[model samples]
Target: GLAERKKVTHVAMESTGVYWKPVYNLLEAEPIEVLVVNAQHIKAVPGRKTDVKDAEWIADLLRHGLLKGSYIPHRAQRELRELVRYRR
Candidate 1:
């Protein structure tokens, strides 16, 4: 993994509603911090429009500490949320 390979300690991701959950779950347990920014904010920035370029744009913004991360509850809290929703 890049985290182990490069001794990376931080990662950034743009939130995409519920879709980001599984990815978040996978990364949360790792020895790295996960940042989830609003997807709309990242998409609003002008840049060389392309699949790869978009990622680069985000990386640049994140690298500069220009992006803000959204709060993500711990796994236990998420599971509790799901349980309550299911019982509703």
Candidate 2:
């Protein structure tokens, strides 16, 4: 995996609706700290606009421990919520 290849210890990603869920799930089991940051928070900090530039900015922020991760429920809780929704 890229993370293993790079020996990354932490990862930060912007929360964009439900898009971050799958990626988060994939990373959850890895031996790494995964931070799902709010898009609003990222936008609140002024930075470059291009995707490449945005990635660089995010990396810099993460490296400096400036990113804040949003709360994510445990896998069991998430599954329960999904079951309840399906039942409804």
User: Each model's C-alpha lDDT?
Assistant: 0.84, 0.89
Alpha-carbon RMSD, each predicted model: 1.8, 1.6
Q: What are the per-residue Cα lDDT tens digits for candidate 1 across 12-85? A: 88788788788888888778978989988888866567868877887898889888899888889999999999
Backbone clash total for model 1 is 0
TM-score for each model: 0.84, 0.87
The 10 consecutive residues of candidate 2 with the worst lDDT sum are 40-49
* lDDT, model 2: 0.89
RMSD of 1: 1.8
Write candidate 2's Cα lDDT for 4-52 as tens digits: 8899899899999888999999999888999999988887656577878
